[model samples]
Target chain A: MADVARLAGVSHQTVSRVVNGHPNVREETVLRVRRAIEELGYHRNSTARALVTRRTNVLGVIAFDTTLFGPAQTLSGIERAAREAGYFLSMVSLDDVSPDGIVAAAEYLVQQSVEGCVAIAPQRSLVDALAALPGPHPLVAVEGGEGSGLPVVCVDQVQGAHDAVRHLLELGHTTVHHIEGDPLWLESEARVVGWRRALEEAGAPAPEPLQGDWSPRSGYALGRSLVARRAEGERVTAIFVGNDQMAIGVLRALHEAGLRVPGDVSVVGFDDVPEAEFLTPSLTTVFQDFAQVGKESLALLLGEIGTERNGSPGPSATERRVVPARLRVRGSSGPPPP
Target chain B: MADVARLAGVSHQTVSRVVNGHPNVREETVLRVRRAIEELGYHRNSTARALVTRRTNVLGVIAFDTTLFGPAQTLSGIERAAREAGYFLSMVSLDDVSPDGIVAAAEYLVQQSVEGCVAIAPQRSLVDALAALPGPHPLVAVEGGEGSGLPVVCVDQVQGAHDAVRHLLELGHTTVHHIEGDPLWLESEARVVGWRRALEEAGAPAPEPLQGDWSPRSGYALGRSLVARRAEGERVTAIFVGNDQMAIGVLRALHEAGLRVPGDVSVVGFDDVPEAEFLTPSLTTVFQDFAQVGKESLALLLGEIGTERNGSPGPSATERRVVPARLRVRGSSGPPPP
Candidate 1:
């Protein structure tokens, strides 16, 4: 520490602050200290630190369906946040999304001596399981929404869903049809609620909801059914989809059916995933700040753990944060065909 | 064990074998025993087992960019394999894929008391770093090819790439353009090698490859440049993209340019991801056995670790296993334009 301090013309306390990832340090000074530390091959030995503090210096993450775009992005965010907080992240994934699955995974992570855990799977049943688990460590939920009795950080899926459906309704279309996400996820249910809410307020009949498993294939299949209905001369002018992948499916189905998006059928999707905008006509979708959700999830967990490394008790009462979703209007959606 | 046997109407040994995930057990018997265990809330206490056997019953995995389809599937594979072997899996993802980064990640895992570790990142430098790290724990590599002084298991990228290019060449194309993946991945370099080799054998020109960072955007960008070259009346007939995500990108760009796929251009992609079949013109891709890779990774690591849990030392002379890759013919690629 002293060697790095002398090399960077900084005091020992400043070097400690930089190494500990203190946010108050000036950016340029942090860079200078980092350079000196790198040149000196100075690494804050986590093992030695663990011995002194009696804490593992490891944080645990419980995520599910990591192959999906949203969960994958959130997991990445949690990892970045943990690293920046000077903690190593250890993760355990559930092959099954059942409550028992969460319980088993939590038990495993808890046994590994994780100082804190961030549960990243957002199904209601999983949240219930998380709430029921006896934890010796602080736990936080991302995308799990509120009412789990644990601190939660999430993008408001309900509002995001509402914005998407309302966009279609406001496009002068009498009714907006929706294809929702997996039933296992609370996000899916929340989206359904938002879609129904928008329709109820507009005095438009909320058509019997269709279910999708969050795959592009499901969207395509469901879109094919809707196309069949359109072939029968039904008024299906506008649609809102649960997520981008399924929307892609719907787009492909509509394309194959010889219908033009936003012309034959105006469409809106959720989670403006990176590929969403680059789709042939591009996508008009809701964008959730998943990265912020992840960062806040970890920060909340650390606060619960009450570590001096990330400063004093994280938020004595800062239990939940709801990140707002933004809508990106792209070429895929517009006024209903005259 | 005795109680479970009595409850399930099976012998004590049968109950033990089933609990341990022995492959020899009959399917029906396995189900019966599992039901009894679940109904009775029987859980294998890993901590107690660790104390009795001096093994942590825990394994470590080091991966990178798991959000990508290939790595994410492999990580899930490893998790499944580990659980089936009655071991808990702890994974640490490297935000950066480099020799130093991998070394640090490995050191962290080693300190966490992992009995064995699976190195899942596929960068050559990472392999080199793994070879250099001192470790008391056993180690194995997946998607990492030979000569790393450690056991390596991987899909034969060279063969896969060669097959993809050869398929294009045999279609009577004069030359094939390649969009390679990230330079940091060994898979990218191997694919490049295979493309060049196939072109050499066919006595055809292999254009200097364009690079992609395995995103749809990069693929779309590279695809647009090709579109421009085609507009200038250059032969841009066949392209072999690095992965399906990029292929989608190229497909979008080409579609926008009014190029008739298979009539004016033929494209082949790697990693037959789930969405490949549903793309506007379905994608033809190389399918690597990531599940096998994951299973063998853990099996090999356990063999190196040498315990009663997973049987013998995997390969006393553990070298490498090259899982074969298959080419899936879909709608995207066809005979080149006359």
Candidate 2:
């Protein structure tokens, strides 16, 4: 530190300010200190600095099932947002979603002295586990549905599903059948609610929704069952799948059954996955701004952290942030069996 | 420590050993200490412990483009392995792939006093930047190709590509066109090498490869272009696409051009994503065991860290570990049109 200060011809405090990214440091002085530090290869020891300043500038992010597209995209969004906010992330991804696992992950982060935590809690169990934790650390949940009394940032899953159903109904379909995602997920439950509500509002019959474990194979299986029902004289004119991956399977099942999409059955999916646009019959689906969800979660977490640091009462526990879901209509949805 | 010792009827050192997970502690003693600690809701301060024992129990992971399937899966695998190994990950995902960005991420991890780092450096620039870092910190590269003298763990991309092409040639394709992934990636380069080599060995002409940015849209666009070449009297009987997402697009393109998969065109892809099997004509693709790659990278990194701690010379810089890729033969690839 002394060598960098001397080389930069700056005072010790000025060098510290520049290194710490203090806003008061002049551009020229910051440049000089940075150049000197680079030339000396002087990397600041964050551990020692953290001890002195009591600020680690590190945030914890607990995620689950990151191999899935939604969780994975949300995590990537959070990483980008954390970096842009000048905070590093200490990430813990739980392969198994259990109460003990959630508590253990939170405890681990607390031990690391992370300023706050953001959990991608999409399942009710995960949200409950996080809400039950006894700690002073600030926490913000992403896609954690209501009633846990924790601040949350989520895409409006119900609204997204409702829109898809409404679009299919307006296309002259009397009713829209749904292939629900894993029943354990809060997202699946919410989408089911939306689909049911839309059907009720339209005075249309609501058939029992088929359950899927959010896999393409499950979708394919359930889709084949729907095809059989159609073969048995049931009206299976339109289908709303829980996610795009499952939707792909549904498309395949319908194709194998010689059912032309929109020509015989209108298919809709959620998650507007990248390949949605190029499917055999381009999919009409819901788009969740996963990155926006991430950004909003970080902003909420930072707010809580700031309140804690300032010794001020934070926002209400029920604070909710909803990133709106958009419906992207394409070739898969059209007039039903004209 | 004193409180836990008193409650557990054990010495402070016994409690310490139990808390630190040290061996040699009696099972009864460990259980007693744990119960006491749980009863008191005791949580160890990792920062202080790190300062005293100089063991942070944290490993740094610098990743890039994690929104993509390959990187995302690899990261998930690494995360699972790290937890099993009892280490927390300080992850930095770079949105931009540049030398300066890589160096900055490395420096950031160093500041956190991470014991070692595993960089998911699949790009040439990333490996170069990591290799250029002037630090004593142990580093391992995951998916970083040969050269640059770094301990690397990666799937055998060349062999995977060779297997895909060989399967096509064995099925009686005269020549197979290629749709390579983003050119800057080492995986893309290596796959192209394997594809070319297989064609060369089979005494087939090597047509120019189309470059796609690993997006389904790019695959759709390139697939249409291939369709055009076929219209112009080119033998576009088979195509080896870079990834499954792109393969989906190509299938749609072929279908639109009245070309039936396996009947008029056979397609193969890499990465064997979960959706591959559920695609219209279940995609024949290469399956990279990302979990194994993650486990191997962590093992290699831990070996380096252990060597550094023991003051022993570490393994050779060019030490390489390759996980074999399996060719999943599905319905998509078959004999070319007669």
Candidate 3:
């Protein structure tokens, strides 16, 4: 601390106030101190700093603001992980993924001098916006890539989708139908690619995918089309939905159309969300380890912050670590009704 | 901005760097300007501030870290409102209501220079923690008390519970059985109180409340006890579950025990989550206006910030606005089975 103060040409008290996040420090002094700290590769153990600085211990997590199962799970997972790691979390939900929102969140964090940050970017807009901002401190992105190049941690959606479709093929199904999530989501696109690759690998027919907005209503509306095909005797025997919620709707549509599940039609969904097992005839779906995603993202962010303190230069090795997803078989899927 | 710089005895460039959220500022100068601004109660119009600041025009949102229906819906509501209000959101989630987490989130927002902030404190921990810290900027709590005496907006859980119980009473049931959420949650406690008050007023048996953790698994476990009681010739003909997820579990348990919904037993749930209407027998539950909760909280926070800028002393008036919850009748609830 004294060395940083010396390098920045400031008193130890001034450094203490800045490190403690007093919010009354001069902007210029903060910049100089930060630069000095970076140049000297000085890192403060917040716990030790708190003893002298009378500071509160906290870690802020910035995530995509949504109730979608993925985001919700990720949020819960991060919170649990943060708690386990001896940090508390403060949350912010953005109305849009704009540059202003990113800057605002960043400024808010700076004012608080949040020890570190984990920003969950499920969409492209947030990633780009965050990438342009100056490296304020240790920032990590969950599922964010492209220009941000920040350390990313995400579930292996492409591999998960591949496994789900491959399961159907192994069951001797000639072809499988797909119900995908919103096209804009990276996971959604990745799943689409995996689905196509699986079908192509086996020389199976790949029908034009059915579009969905990750809602049961969207699935229900699109399910009607599949039902119509069933009535015309040209039905696709197995369906892999983007999520469990939409899968429920598809099941309802099939039931209403007099098609028995796993008998007349087989179904598989992603995100083995809660309630999947309790569905009238439990659902077969892919399970994502969201808790793992949260834990890894935090660890990754902390690592980057630690490295930055060591004066490591030239874009830290930011790479995506994909968590694996598993298939849970139940009543919703089986061999195509012979 | 110039006046603040002059008053604080800092250079114009230093003030610009502070306002623009440049990471290169000194902590001491930052504190001086902040104190001066507070003393002057000076606030910059974000739009004009944006032009000079070169910010991305983004706002950070502290999201409730849960997959529970209410929190998810409220988050989505905030996102939608933010977009309409012409801002973007960067969100963070915490696992538990840890003061450290809340502080971390607040600090993160401060560093980002977020125009303002809203903390969703369904649990008391976050709220109590936020109270201890010096608020860095405009702040509000959703589903939390107007306790901070700051602007507060939320769905009236007390009223919602009252409406649910009253509806059950009006249906000719002697008394409604209650399945309560975790006792620690403020909303849960509020609902429990409302349920108890309604029953006490009607001189009906409150029947030591059955406990649930707001999960289908817990609901299923509790439902088994009810089913066993029925087998022993005791029956709870009508039940009010705390949330839809739990209600689904209760319904499944009863179904497995050969009891028919609204036939052998009547059940009602809260949240009226999207899939509630599609449940096998559908669900009769309470509908909360999540969007209203989000909009009102934002307005309250922004309004409070506005008042602060106008040099008003504290809030003009305490807003204890509780958006009402409605009873949505479906196949789940009915008169006591003959």
Best model per TM-score:
2
Across B123-233, the per-residue lDDT of candidate 1 in tens digits comes to 888887887787525788887767777789899999999999999898888899999988778899999999999999999987899999988899999999999988898
Candidates' interface RMSDs, in order?
Answer: 4.5, 1.2, 8.9
Candidate 3 per-residue lDDT over residues B216-242, each given as its tens digit: 888888988988977897758888888
Listed in order, the DockQ scores are 0.23, 0.76, 0.23
- Chain B only, TM-score of each candidate: 0.83, 0.92, 0.80
The CA lDDT of each predicted structure is: 0.83, 0.91, 0.76
Better of 1 and 2 by TM-score: 2
Predicted model with the maximum DockQ: 2
Task: Point out where model 1 deviates above 4 Å.
Answer: A1-54, A307-318, B1-54, B307-318
Candidate 2 lDDT by residue in tens digits, A35-99: 99999988776776777778888999999888898988899899889988999898988878788
Comparing candidate 1 with candidate 2, which one achieves the higher lDDT?
2
TM-score for each candidate, following the candidate numbering: 0.81, 0.93, 0.71
Count of clashes in candidate 2: 0
lDDT of 3 at A199: 97
Model 3 chain A worst lDDT window (10 residues): A46-55
Would you list the clashing residue pairs of candidate 1? B303-B314
Q: TM-score for the first chain of model 2?
A: 0.92
Ranking by DockQ: 2, 1, 3
